[model samples]
Target: MTGKLGIGIITYNRKDILQTTISSIFRHTKTPFEFVVADDGSSDGTPDLLKQLNVPHVTGRNKGISWNRNRVLWYLKEEKGCDWILILEDDCFPSTFGWELPWIEALERYGHVNYMPEITIEIDNDITSGSGTAEDPFIAPMHQAFCVGYHAKALSYVGYLDVRFEKYGEEHVEHTQRFLRAGYGGLSQYLSPERGQLFYLRGGLDTLPSHSHGNPEIAQRNQAIHNSIRHEPLYRHPWRTDEQMFEFREEIATALTRPPVEPPSDPQLFNSIISLGGDGIVNRAIKDNFHWAGLGLFDQFLVPFHTLTAFLQHNFAGLLSTTCLYGYHDALRCRDTLTIYHNCLDKPAHVHASVEMFHEQLPALQYRFRSMIQEMDELCHKTQRVLFIRSWRDGLYYKGQHRPDHSATPDFRALTDAIAARYPELDFRIMFVNFGNAYVDDPRMIFANTRTPDDSTAEEELAGWKDLFSKHRITLLQNR
Candidate 1:
C-alpha cells in the first residue's frame, strides 16, 4: 500500500489562526506531504493568502465545516492521488516533539489505522490533553485531527461527513462509529511533553472561551448542518435514545424523503417568520370579519377563528396538515365558552344547542376541525398522546398569540375529564402555557381551573363523559 500523505486542513474565517497552523505544519513536519486547504466561503482574506502560498487548495461553494473536510478528501483522492490523508482543523498547530514522525510511525505500525494524537487544549493557565493510548482502553475523541489512511478499497466503503452535521458535535463520533462498525481499528499516540507545550499556544480548540464564544455563527451553522444530517435517510442509527435527537432525525428523514422545496437559505428561521406573519394576517382577517358582524371590538368572536385559521395556515397548509388538525381541535375546546355564549344569545329557548351547533360548524372551519380531531385520535392513539402534544402540535400550527387563556376556555376541565374517562388505556400529558396577565387575572389560572375538588371527584366526572363519548378514545392532558 502506498504510504504517501496528503495534509488536509479545513478553515472558515480564522485567517490568522490558519496561517499559524500552516506555518507550524511546514516547520515541525519534515515529511513530504501535499498540503490541501479547504476553504468554506471565507469572507476574510484567507483565500488571497492561500493563493499567495501557492498550495493546492479547494474552495467550497457554500459554508459548511463538514462539507469542507469532505471536499478536501475528494480533492486529495482525485487530484493529489495520495493514499493517506492527515486531516487537521484550521487551529491545530502540530508541535515539535516528533509530532509528524509519530503520526507516520503509528500509521506505518498499525497499517490501515485511524490515528488520533493526544491533543493538549490550552485555556489561560489550564491545559487539557488525552490520557489513554492504543494499548489501553480507548476513549474516542470528537475531532479527527491526527491521521486517517484511505485505501482504494475502503474509499468505496466510507461515506462523506454528514454535511448536515455542519457544526462541531457528533459528526466525528458518527464517522468513527461507522468505520469501526465496518471493522476498522483506531490508533492513538501520545505527544511528547515538550511538544505539548506548543499545544498551549494553539488557542483555537481550547475550552476556555468555548467554540460558541470563538465563533457564534459556527454554532448556528451547526444546527442547520445537524438538521440536514438528521434529515438524511441513510444516517439513521437505531441506538440513539434522546427524544430531541430522535425528533430531529425524524424531521430530517421527513425533509429528505419529501421533494425539495426552494426554501429560503434559512428554512427554520424563515418558517418562524412566516408563522408569525401568517398569524398576524389571520388575526387581522378574523378581527375584520367580527367587526363587520356587529360584535364589539372587545368581543372575543375572532379569538377562536383567528387561532384556528392561523394554526391551519402556518403548519398544515403544506406538509404538516395532520399536525394542524390537532391544533384546530384544541382551538375549538378553548373557544367553547364563546360558542356556548353565542348559542345562548342566538337561541334563548335552546341552551343545549351550542355543542351541536359548534359540531355542525366544525366542518366548514379552515382546518377541517371535526375530522382533524378524529385523525389526531387515530394518529397519536391512546398510548402516545401527552399534554406536551397539545402545545407541541398547537404551537407548530400557529405562531400567533401564545396566550393559553385565549385558546383554553373555562370549561376545559369538563372537556379534559370527559376525554380522560373515554380513553382509559391512553396517557395524556398536558401543560398549561400560562399567557400571564393577558387574558386572566393569574397566569396560573388555566392550571387552577383544570383541577377538580379531589382526584376522585375529577375521575367520577370524567367517567360520566367517558360514557357519553364511549366510541371515541380521547386522552385528556393534565397540567402539571
Candidate 2:
C-alpha cells in the first residue's frame, strides 16, 4: 500500500462514456493514484477528448481488448514503475469516494481481486467462500474483467494478457483461471445498494449501450482459444518470449494499417495466401502480387520428407514438437527437418531424424496432427476463401545437405485430395509451385510454375498463373 498505485482505463471509440467515466473517477475516488488511459485505435474523437482532459494515455491501432490491456500492463507496471495496478474498462465508473481502499486492502492480502459491478453482480454456485460483509466479501470465480486489481508481484507472476484472445469475451476468463491455478486469491466482491454504489457497469453483451468492440464471430473465436488452453499449465517461464513480445508490439503498432487493396471482382477470391511448408516460389508469388503480403510460418523454410504420408502426418510436428540437440543443449532442432531454433546460437545443430527416431516419435506425431487439424478446422471461419501454396519434393538431408531423391507429386496429390475432402465446405485451394509433374488433373489443385527452359520471366509466369486461376473462377490479386 505504501508503493506507487497506477490506475489504467482502457477505452475504444466511446468518447462520451470514457469522458463520463473519467469524470466519475475524479469525483468519487479520493485515493491518490497515477492514472493513464490505453486507447484502442479510437477514431471517434476519443483521442481528442483524452488530449483535452490532459490525461496521460497510450494510443495505438485497435488491436483488441487483450492487447489494449497488455499495453496498460506494460505502461503502468514496466514503464511507470507502479507497485500496484488497477485496470478498468471505460464503462465501469466508481460510485463512491474511497471506493479504491477496499480493493487496495484486498490486493495487499490476496495479491489480486476482481471488482464486481452492482448491475451485473450475482451470487453463483462457484463461490468459494465469504459473505457480503466488508470483512469478507463474497468470493467466487472471476467471471468478469471490467475492473481488476493486482499487486506488482502477482502481475509479474501472471504476465501480460494473452494477446491471442483477440477482441473480447473469454480473455478475462482465461487470465483469471491462469491466476487461480497458480494459487492466487481474492476473487471476492460485494455490490452496493444504490446506483453507482460500488461500480456502474454499462457494457458487455446484454447491457444497454453495450460494448462496441467485439462481434459474435470474434467471441466464438476467443472462446475456442480459451477452451483449447483451459487445462494448460500455469506460467513459470514468461508467457511470451522477448522476441514474441517484440512481434506482438509491432502487430499492435500496425493493426489494421495494411495498404488498401481493391476487392477482387469476384467475392470468392482470397485476400491472403499463406504458404503451407513449401519452397520460396509461393513466397515470391505472394510478394509480387500483393503490396502488403507478409511472411508466414512456412515461408522460406524447407520441409524435406521421404513420402507424402509421412509429410502429411508429421509436418506440423516437425515444426512445433522440437527438442534440444545432443552435444548442443543450447540449440533446439526439429525431429523431422533441418530447422534449428535460435539461429543466433553459434552451435552445430543439424537434426535429421533417423528411421528409428521417426518410429519412436509416432505418438508425438499423432498428437501434433490432432492439434494441428483442430487449428485447420478453425481456418474455415477466418475467411471466405484462402489459397495455400506448396511445393512437394521427395528428399532428405545427409550430414546437413539436401539431397533430392525423387518427386513427391503423387504424395502432394494425395495430401491435397484428403484435405479437400476433409473440409469440403471450405475454399481450401492448394497451388503446387513446381513444374513437370505439378500439373495435377484435380479440381481442388492449382498448378503454377516459373515455366523452365522456355525462359519465362517472373512476370510472365505470374500472368500465366492469373489467367489459369481466372479460368477456374478464382481471382488473383495484382500489385496495386
Candidate 3:
C-alpha cells in the first residue's frame, strides 16, 4: 500500500459488530488505506477472524481501549509510515459516499482539517441526528466517527493519544483539546442528512452498574492498574527530546510533592455529621444533601465507595474523622445510632429515613445493590467503619393500584439467598434485615400497603431468610 492512509479501529468482545464495521469500510474505500484493527485481547474469536482477513493488525496485551489505539497509531507511524489516520468505532459504519471523490476534495479544500461525522440514532419510530461538533454549551458526539489528516510536518507537532484514559469516553475529547491547544483547528461536517446510523445496543453507556463476584484477585488487579497509572508520570510534551521531556517530568514530580496549606481553626463551630441508611435512596440522599465537608462524600459514593474510602484513608489519614460522618445503609439498620456516635465523637448526625422497597420481582436491581454494597465495604475498610447498620427489613405488598404477584415474591427470596451465600464471612457480625411480619409485628408501618394476600407471604419470606442466616452463621436483626 504505497499511498496509504492508516485507518485504526479498536475493539473488544464485540467481534460481530467489528466485522460488520470492517466489511462496510472495505466496501466504501478502494483508496489505498492500510486498515489497522487494534484488538484489546478479545476472547470472542475476534483474533481468528482478523487473521483470516489477512490485514495488518496489532493485538495488545489485555490492556484497555486507549492503550490499544495508542499502540496501533504508534505502529502506523513508526512501522507503516502512514501519513493520515482515520479513527472509527466498531459500532459505526461509513456510507458509500464516505469513500467517494467528495471526501478527498473536501480534504484538499481544507488541508490538515479534522472532520467529525454526523451521527444518527435509530429509535423505534424516529431518528435523532447530531453533527459531532463541540458547540458552546454542549460537548461533541465524542464517540462518532472522525478523520485526522496528518501533514508531514504536522506529525511532529501532533502527538499520540493519552493512554491514561483507558476507556472509550474522554480520550477523544482530550485529543481534540490537545489539538486546539497546539493551534490546530477542526471542523464538524454532516455527511448527509442520514449519514451514519447508531444501532442502539444493550449496555451502551459505560457507567452502567455491574456485579463484583467477590473475587479479591480481580480487585487486586484493578488496584494495581490504578496505582501504576497514578505513579506513572504522563509526559505530554512528547515532541521534546527524551532528555528535555524527562527533565520536565521530574519538575512536575517535584511540583506535585510540595504541598502544605492549613486552614484557620474554628473552635466554636465544630464539624457537622450526617448519617444515611438504605440502598439507592440513601446513596442519592447523602450525595445530594452533603457538599460542605470539602466535597468528599459526594465523590465517595461515585462508584466503588469502599475503594474511594480506602484511597482517602491512605492519602488523607484523619481528615474524615476530623470532619463529619454520614451513615448510609441497606442491609443492617440497627447500628444507625451507635455507628453515628462511635465514629462521629459520640455525637449523632441527621438520620436520613430509610427507603421501603415495594417491588419484589426485580432481581436485576439486586446487581446494582450489590455493586453499591461492595463500594461501601471498600470504604468501610478504609475508614473506622463509621457507617453501621444493625438490621434492615424490606418486603413487597400491594401498593397504590398495583396488585401483588405470587411469582414476584420468589425473586426477593432468591436475592436474600444469594446475599446470604455470597457474604458468609460477614454473617455473624452483619445483620441481615427482612421485611416480614413474622420478623416484625407491624408490616404496615415499615411499608405502605394497599392490598393483602389470602396468606401472609412475608412470614414465609422471613422463615426462608432465617434459615439461610442460620446456615451461614450470620446474625439476623429484625427492626420493629
Candidate with the larger lDDT of 1 and 3: 1
After superposition, the stretches of candidate 1 with alpha carbons farther than 4 Å from their true spots are 108-154, 186-480
Candidate 3 overall lDDT versus native: 0.38
**Each model's RMSD to truth, in Å?**
20.8, 18.4, 23.8
Q: Encode model 3's per-residue lDDT on 373-402: one tens digit a residue.
A: 455455444432122211221111112111
Number of the top lDDT candidate? 2
**Which is better, 1 or 2, measured by lDDT?**
2
Compared with the true structure, what per-residue lDDT tens digits does model 2 show for residues 318-380? 454435333224333455455533322223457533434534654765565566556555654
Q: Please estimate how well model 1 matches the true structure, expressed as its whole-model Cα lDDT.
A: 0.41
Ranking by lDDT: 2, 1, 3
Off by over 4 Å in 2: 122-129, 132-134, 186-209, 236-244, 247-480
TM-score to native of every candidate shown: 0.37, 0.47, 0.35
Candidate 2: what lDDT? 0.57
In order, candidate lDDTs are: 0.41, 0.57, 0.38
In terms of lDDT, the poorest run of 10 residues in model 1 is 267-276
In angstroms, the error of model 3 at 369 is 63
Better of 2 and 3 by lDDT: 2
